[model samples]
Target: NLEYQGAFLYGEITANYDVRNHLFEDIKLRYDDIYKGHTLELGNYKYMDDGAREWDISFKKDKGYIITGSKNYVIKENVPLGSRVELLYLGIIIDIQNATNGVVEFKNDEIKEDRNYQLKIYTPDGKILIKDISTTSNYNQQNKGEVEYDINIREDHESKRNKIDSKVYYGLTDHLTLGMGYLREPELINDEYEYLDKGRLEAVYSNYIYSLPYTFRVGGDKVFNEFEYKVNEKNTKDDYSYDFLGQIDIKKVRLRLEHESKGEFYEDKYKTKFYVRYTPIKALDLEYEREEATKRDGIYGIDYKEKINKYSIEYSKAYKDLLLTGEYEYHTEDKGKYSFNTYYTGLRTATLKLENTWKNDGKDYEVAFSIFSNGNRLFDYNLEARYTEQEKDKFTFRFSTNYNNWFDYEMFVDKKGNQEHKFGIDHITDLRNPTAKIKNMDSSPLKVITFVDKNDNDIYDEGEELIKNVEVQIGEQKINTNENGEAMFYGVPNYVTYDLEPKIKKPNFLLGNNKVQVQGKNTATIVAHIPVKPMLTLTGFINVEDILELNSIDKMRLYEELLVTVKDTNGKVIDRAIPDEQGIFEISGLLPKKYLIEVVYMGIDHQIDGINDEIVKLTYVDVRHVS
Candidate 1:
């Protein structure tokens, strides 16, 4: 018998001896984790059982495999990674695992002598290289010939596959852009390192930010072509897909339309959608959508077509930090007596969502719950909570269930200040079957520390002070340090990367680095430093002698109310101050850098008197005396 719990499998075997004077030898069974690309061998002790014999099976996975018994495995070389291998005895799956490191290992003694043990390795015949398109950053606003490109590189965790993607955007005009993109992946078959390629071309016109703005886009993608290795000829049709999108926005209303067609030459499918939204008030929104789909299937000159239509309406309201939304949709299909689909019947669904957020004691909490009900059956129910303080130092929880068949819960908590804290076992179960329960647990931590760099060095010295109450951020959660100047984030998911940054609130203090990238699974600690520099004071006064020499009444009178402004080398305003009754003004907290000091009086703006030419350098001592 075989049982499944999430991504793991459990199997049991039993045998009985019919004779009282019979003696049995050692019996063994093997099982493997096909998803993780690993295998295991287990053996039972020598025994003679009159009734039945049983063995408890278990597995613990890691980078390497370990077996319970000493049995040598014969490995088949050059099998290739990602190839599915199956171990069969008497035409039944005794064990199955994927090849790792381009080889499959198995022992022949695990199978019965009466049956033939056969191993088979199968490879994919066809695969889709790219199914979605995405871009990066904002469009270029330059007049012409300006180009912006986004590149993405990805490699599988097992290092068996790689993907290289690139997208380019050219500014043909102020409101138009010409775009192209390409994606590459290795072919799934054959021995050589041949790659498959897909490309797209598009023309986009968007002026949505103006008073009367609209947008239109037209694009097409070239599909991948299949090849037949046996005939040594490329076997494919002239396949392609096209898409069109248009949107218009008026004061309180918006309209959008979209259409897409795929497989123009064979097995064609077309879809179209229309949407309208109206928002007459700041708290209320209403929307309506209509979608239609048509599919064609043809083989050996015999063709069949099918059509489906769907309509939906949605209403949402927002009050303070709480949002509520409800949607209802209906679906119908064109049917005939000889049709592949059922006769035209209406199917209805209704979904409701409620979300709320609040803050308490410098911590933020959020709760969102949504449910979808089709006819009288509940389809999905999802509830998520983030950073909700349970007692003192724990948060981040989620709960989801669907059709009463599946349930999932996730939570994470820290144990004191230790970074290596495991979450309590989460019971993912099928409610209809009480015996099926999967318990998943994990423990990992990410800690960030802030310290004062006293000697202006990049390294953290022993005598450097640990600054308390420094803010650190992982994702959107902002955490402050404890008394020890350390902040820890618990329940971080595995196999992901996070960008860590420090939120400094003090001026004239610079961080050593702006952002740091951290990977999950391993305990990560980042040390950050803030170096504070000394400030220079610029003090000056309107020269009485120059005012008297001018002799003009307007010139001398203007000296009484003089304005002084200081700007850095980048022309950013640093400080502004007006002289007191004595015509003496002072600006402090200015860094020791080049600056431009401007003196304005009597509708005239001119450079300060003490500045050399148009710039002033303040390094040591205060810069004084100016008219």
Candidate 2:
């Protein structure tokens, strides 16, 4: 493409080829010179052996370099005896200067980002020595929106048939979504079929009304079935369906309502449901819901008219971090064997559910069980369990299972980014052949790394140690580092912001950035770094002359005690120190900053007409006296 501005051009070229055997490679090159500084990018993707894959991307601009492939660096420092200096990466301490005496030596294997750092020197007893310093930058992975498609395959041995379902969804905007779905066969497992037996195009719009949320959805669907003996055009059918939903959420109350109408192959049905929830206090919540459904069945077989009404009530309470909920439901249905007639058969059913949720560390866990029975038959029951852990950096991990032999496991790599890779194993209804599944995931999974910045440089040094037991969170999933200081999250979604934060914070450590925007299923990695802060001890004196006494011979000790105030550069008073018996006062553990010190004096009226103050720059320990 050519642009009129300076007659510049911009274009991209992509190529794919098989290197050898089962090995394949893809290359993309982009060029643009519309601005003062021309730009070029070379991206290479390779499918490695044993199903491994990797990507290499390079970008170039103008005369100076923006990013190079990789580099190594080192750091060396002299330290006092009994000083504890540690290098931290991703908030985990990787190296510490444990020597009681001698020069302190530290270095990193790489250069990462550019920023300021707080370097802490601590005493052997864990008291702080010197704390503040400046650092640089390290590498950060950029996340972008991604699109994904999923296909499900199932086979039934009893029926000798197979099923395949494909679905895709993409967001046109934050509130508008579009989707498509297709289901093949009458549970047909064979590949001999050429046509998709059923397909649908769908769209949904969601918006908010102050504290209330609402959504509208509409979709068009079509299905075709051919008799074994003959195929006819009339066998195909198409229809439209829609749904409306609304909800209101407040601190102590919530309400939700939904209505949906559908057109099926044999009949049309409509259903409506509404819920009301109230929280009378912090620890307790009450809720009620009602559902109504009317369906006309038997269009092709034994016909019947059915109407169902259901009502449920629930109570929930919080016991510290644990939450428990119990619910009871009553359902009644009327059915006319042939049509809406005078003689109707009525059925009543009841169900009960109990759920509990709690948290350990920064992760959330939940368990729910339900019992349902119609009349006096054997009761049907199911139990569910879910566990989730999220880090301060937005890395997340989730696990769920049900009594029906169904289970789901998911790991999110970068919760702070717009895109994420998701790895999952889902819905194993048949134990004989568990369906291992992957969604919103490419051939490669997303990576989240934690390391220590030993040199106080923003760059990531090769030898810089990786820290273990550190929690990394992507969105709502959390995982802790193993012995090697690494945690991997899978099944990340695209086109959304996944903020990452550490669940646990170490003392004297400060975080850099807590989140990143990740793009879809494409492999992405985010590194969260926390640097230690430097400490200082500030000593000062407050001297009062008591000038009104004039002839007082002991001027030096005229007023042995006085009050002094310390304010930061922003004029915010952070600390106050008063001299002890020796007229000397000291404050420790203070970070480097400019401070305003003042000597306060008062008369019998407790009012000050004039006072002297001093401003000093403090990085390390220093003595400042005021009168």
Candidate 3:
């Protein structure tokens, strides 16, 4: 039987034999991170149960196969690095601890350190490789507080040359390190001017200017640059170059700068770099970079958005259903010459975006389209619609309107027998479960047009009329603002309010300042403004003799949302209300409680002192709602 706890596995066993068994295996599966790193699997699994035994099992897992005589594993120092062990615990046969079989081994069997005095070499895979002095080496411990030497040699033959060069550093104190090196035999042309030798000395400190999210890092790389160029086989001019980079993170944004100078004396060329970024707000980001005429240059980009909120206009672009963005980018050579061609004064890059939606229940529809232009002069557009319903006698509505620079197309459908005759354009047909078919027009990358019902007789009634701008508002409460500057509410008990206000200012045509009391859902339409007129007025508020507005009512009806709060003294909220479609709300399942009634109507709210449902409150009556 075996048991598991935390990150360890425990097991037990029992067997019988009294000196009658010969060569009986006594193995206790012992897994103690047997091996870790490159030469081993995540951890090694050894089958410690060498021969047949009373009970045994092996698993290549967290509890890698190990068998020991005791419950705990042997200490790393006690276990010989290359030897395998198998043991017995209590009365159980554990596992197998296979001997090392696939690698180089020495007579003493202690992981051979570098075979020779070599520090780096190459494997058959042709990849340059490096190995550090093992922790077991006295040389490593002697140089403990020093930068370990890292050497590199050719993948061809490492033992032949001292291409094995590395910088070794030794620490003398907490802030200072004394270091020196002669790693490479710098080649000399004609032996006139050469690198000869190189060395370094440095100091470091902490606990400087402090900030929670920002940090400052300062360091320098000093490379002795020396070399002479041979012209016509004779020593001529010399070449030297040095460089350094400073990077810091200030408040989450990154700041980086690099400075480099090449060539000796008067011919040296120096280049300086600067970059900064700030994200002051979550939704907006700003950046800037400049490398001057010495090479790099560019005024980066800043972007933001404001599309989903009410009373807002979108400043965006689109291409074939994909939305694009805008930004300013300057250039000075890097991303390839002509990356920012100075030859063109009018050509600019542009991105596009298109909106898409799916339709299945299929009756409701809405459309919005726009085209933004830059010097790139690219084109893009997309339209989407969706509708779903669960009822049959559905008088669903769908209408089209044009708001862009595209060709126009018209459509109409007639049903006969079991087939439908769709007019004007091509229709791709699709059908789904429980008997439903959808016929749609083909989409294109070119021009597009929208068709609006002309005579208001959605039947595609022929020869009736074809008015281009015939005030196409769809609904039964159809209307046209008369010469008297207004259209009367018809079919609809109350005049309709347009969600968007007008933009023009002259010859004002507006929603009537009147309220109609009727119960039930009703659709109303009214003449917004005359052709070429600018009227921006809304009319939907009740009032009381120039002093206050209509705040409370008894048996009247309303269509908008209301926040009804029932409360008592000490500002304690007792209950609240949310009305439904018919402007009728009966908050039931309520236990008897004291409450002050506050009614939210139109844009104003009204409350009154406690009044029992047993008494009828008069219309438009004002009560202290409580003191």
Q: Judge candidate 1 against the unseen true structure and give its global Cα lDDT, from 0 to 1.
A: 0.49
TM-score of each: 0.33, 0.29, 0.22
Best model per TM-score: 1
Q: How many clashes (backbone N, Cα, C below 3 Å) per candidate?
A: 0, 75, 28
Across 517-616, the per-residue lDDT of candidate 3 in tens digits comes to 2221211122222222112211112222244344345323332445455554345665566555434444332222233455554443434222222221
Per-residue lDDT for 20-93 in model 1, tens only?
Answer: 34644333333334233233434333323442333322232222212334213332422322344555333333
Give all candidates' CA lDDT scores: 0.49, 0.44, 0.28
C-alpha lDDT (0 to 100) for residue 270 of candidate 1: 79
Q: How far does residue 360 in candidate 3 sit from its true spot (Å)?
A: 42
| Candidate 3 Cα deviation (angstroms), residue 164 | 4.4
lDDT of 2: 0.44
State which candidate, 1 or 2, has the greater TM-score. 1
Cα miss at 304, model 2 (Å)? 7.8
